[model samples]
Target: MNIGIVVFPGSNCDRDCAYVASDVIGQSAQFIWHQETSLGEMDAIILPGGFSYGDYLRTGAIAHLSPIMDAVKAFAKQGGLVLGICNGFQILLESGLLPGAMLRNRGLSFRCEEVYVRVENAETPFTNQCHPGQVLKIPIAHAEGNYYTDPVTLSSLQANAQVIFRYCDADGQSTGPSNPNGSLDHIAGIRNAAGNVLGMMPHPERCAERALNNTDGFLVFQSMVASLKTQARLTAR
Candidate 1:
C-alpha cells in the first residue's frame, strides 16, 4: 500500500515513519507537508510522533488546525486508514478523529522508555498481525501521554472493540505498575468506531527493524499492508 507520512513543523518522527515504510516495510512512501491540502494517491496516512508547532498550546491543539487535516478528515471518513502515534495521537484527539484526550503523565514528568502493550483486539488493521492478548514491547516518549475519556465513551469503545491495546506486563497482564503513563484503563491504543483510524501513544517506528533491538513494531506495519491489500481485492470485486 502507498503511504504518506504527514509532516508538520516540529514533527521529528516524520522521517522515521518514512524510513520504516520505505526501507523497512518495503512500501512506497512519501512525506506530506502540513500545509498541503492534497494527499495525492496515498492509500494510508501516518501522523508520526513529535511536538507539532512545538506544542505551543496544549498538545495537538494547534496542529489540529493545519490545512491538511481537512483532507485527512475527508479521507478517513471515506474509509481510508490513518495511524497517529504519540504526539500524533494527541493531534487525532484534538482533530476529533478519535475519542478521548491526553493528560499529564500521572507522575507530572516526562517518560522515555520501553513499555509492554497487550493486543486487546487483533481484528483492527493496525493489530491484525498480533495474536489476541499478545504483548509488544514498544518505546514511548512523552510528558502528557495519559489518555482519558468519559465513562460513556469508554463503555462504547469497549462494546465496539475499539480499545485495541492496553499497557501490560511482559506476560500480557494489565497492572497498575505496567501502565507507564497512568492512562485510563491502561489504554495504550484505540481505534475509531468505524475501525479505520487508530491513535496510540507508543512509537512503533522506533522498533520496526531488527537493528532497533526488537522487531515487534514491524507487525503493525505488516498488518496495515495486509489490510490494505484485502481492501483492494474487495473493492475490485
Candidate 2:
C-alpha cells in the first residue's frame, strides 16, 4: 500500500507518519503538500498532527481551506481511507469530513501525556487488527483535544457504532480521571458515518515502534495495511 501524508506549513509530524508507513510498515509513502490539488495514486491518506497555520484562527480553521482538502474530501467520498491525528483530526472536523468540533481542554492548558484508549468498534478497517475492548496506550499532545457534539449527533454516533476509541483506564474502564481532555463520553477517536474516515486525538505514530518502549500504537497502522491488502486481493479476484 502507498500512503500519502499531507504536509501543511506547520505540520511537524509528517515525517514520523511517513517513517511508519514506509520504514516500519514496509509500504510506499509520499508527502502531499497542502497546495497540491490531487492525491495521485495513494492507497491511504493521513493528516498528521501539527499546529497548522500556527493554530491562529482555530486549530484547523485556516488549514482546512487548503486546495488539497477538496481532494481529501472527494477521496473519502469515493470510499478511500483517511486517518487524521491530533491537529489533523482538527482539520478533518474543520473540513467537515468528520463530525463534531474540538474545544479547549477542560482546564484550557496544553496536555502532553500518555493515555489508554479502549477500542470500541474493532470491525472498522482502521481497527480490524484490534479486538473489541482492547486497550492501547497512546500519547496525546494538544490544548484543544476536547471533543464536543450535539446530543442528537452523539446519539447517532453511538447508534451507528461510529465511535471507535474512548479514553479508558488500563483495566478498560471509562472513568473521569482517565479522561485526559474532558471529551464527552471520553471519546478519543471516531469515524465518519461511512467508516472510511477516522479522526483521533492521540498520536499513534509516536508509540508505534519498539524503540519507543511501546508498540501498542503499531496496531492501528497494521490494521490499515492489512485491510488494504484484503481489498487488493478481493479486487484481483
Candidate 3:
C-alpha cells in the first residue's frame, strides 16, 4: 500500500513514522509537505505526531489551516482511510474531522512515557487485529493530550462503539491514575462515525519494532493494511 505522511514545519516524528511504514510495515510511504496541495495517489494518509507550527497558536490550530488539510478533508470525504497520531489527532479535532477536543493534562505537565490502553472496540479498521479488552503498550509524549467531550456526544460514542481505546492499568482495568491525561472516561483514542478516520493521542509508531521491546503498536498498522486488503477483496468479488 502507498501511504502519505503529512509533515508540518515543526513535525519531528515524520521520519520515524515513515521509517516504520517502509521498513517495518513494508509499505511505500512518502512525506507530504504541509504546503503541498496534492496528496497524489495514496491508499492511506497519516498525520504524524509533532509540534506543528511550533504550537504557536494552539496544539493544532495553526496547522489545521495548512493547505494540505483541505486535501486531507477531501480525501476523507471520499471514504479514504486517515490516521492521526498525537498532534495529528489535535489537527483532526481542529479540522472537525473527528469529534471532541483536547486540553492540558490534568497533571499540568508534559507526559512522556509508556502507558497502557485497552482496545474498547476492535471492529474498526484501526484495531481489527487487537482483541476487545486487550491492553496495548504504547508511548505518549504530549502536554495537551487530554481528551474531552460532552454528555450527549459521549453517550453517542459509547452507543456506536466509536471509542477505540481507553487508558487502563497493566491488567486492562480502566481505573485509578492509569489515565495519564484525564481524558474523559479515560478515552485515549476514537474513530469517526464512519470508522474510516481515527485520531489517537498515543504514539503507536514509536514502538512498532523489536528494538522498542514492545511491538504492540504494530497491530494497529497491520490491522489497517489487512482491513484494506479485505475491502479490496470484497470489492473484487
Candidate 4:
C-alpha cells in the first residue's frame, strides 16, 4: 500500500503518520506538499493533524483553498480513500467534504489525552475491520474540536450512517466526561456520504503502536487497505 501523507504549512503529524506507515504498516509514505498539483498514483491519502495556517482566519479556512485541495477533491470524487485527522478533519469540514463545523472547545483550552472510541459503523472502509460496538483507544489533541451542525444536517448525517465513532469512557462506554469536547451526540468522527472519506478529531496514527500503549488506530488503516484490496481483486476477477 503506497500512502501519500499530505503536508500543509503547519502539519505536525505528517511525519508521525508517515512513521506508522513505513514502520508498522510496512509501506513507504510519500509526503505531498500542499502546493503540489497531483497525488501521483497514491493508493490513499492522509491529511495529518496540526494547526494549519496557524489556525488564523479560523481553523482550516486558509488551508482549504490550498492548491492541492483540488487534486484531493478529484481523488475523493473517484472513490479514493481519504483520512483526515485533527486539523485535517477541520480541513474536510472547511472544504465541504464532510458535514459540520468545529468550534472552540467548550472549555476554551487545548486538550490532549487518550480516550476510548466506540466503533459505531464498521461497515465503512475506515473501520470495517472492527465490529459495531467495539471500543478502541485513540488520542485527541486539539483546541477547537467541538463539532457542531444544524438539526437538518445532523439528521441527514444520522440518516446516512455517517457518524462512525463516538467518545467512550475507560470501560468503553459513552459519557459527558469521556467526550471532552462536548460534541453533539458524542460524535468523534464522520464519513462522507459515499463512505470513502473520513474525518475524525482523534489521531489514529498516534495510537498505532502497542508500545505507545495504544494500537487501536492501526486496525482502521489496515481495514481501509484490506477493503481496497478486496475491491481491486473483485474488479480484476
User: Residue-wise lDDT of candidate 2 within 1-237, one digit each (tens)?
Assistant: 889999999999999999999988899999999999999998999999999999988999999999999999999999999999999999999999998999999988899999999999999989999999999999999999999999999999999999999999999999999999999989999999999999999999999899999998899999999999999999999
Q: Give the TM-score of each candidate.
A: 0.99, 0.99, 0.98, 0.97
lDDT of each: 0.94, 0.96, 0.94, 0.92
- Judging by lDDT, tell me the better candidate of 1 and 2: 2
Candidate 4: count the clashes: 0
Q: All predictions: root-mean-square deviation over Cα?
A: 0.7, 0.6, 0.8, 1.0
Which regions in candidate 1 have their CA more than 4 angstroms from the true location? none
Whichever of 2 and 4 has more lDDT, that candidate is 2
Candidate 3 lDDT by residue in tens digits, 1-237: 899999999999899989989999899999999999999999899999999998887899999999999999999998899999999999999999998999999999999999999999998889999898999999999999899988999999999999999999999999858999889989999999988999999999999999989899999999989998998899899
lDDT winner: 2
Cα error, residue 103 of model 1, in Å, equals 0.5
Q: Which consecutive 10 residues in model 1 have the weakest lDDT in total?
A: 209-218
TM-score of candidate 4 on Cα atoms, chains taken together? 0.97
Q: What is the Cα-based lDDT of residue 39 in candidate 3?
A: 100
Worst 10 residues of 4 by lDDT: 167-176
Which lDDT tens digits does candidate 1 get at residues 1-237?
Answer: 789999999999999999999999899999999999999999999999999988987999999999999999999999999999999999999999999999999998799999999999998899889999999999999999999999999999999999999999999989999999899999999999999999999999999988878998998999999999999999999
Query: Candidate 4 overall Cα lDDT vs. reference?
Result: 0.92
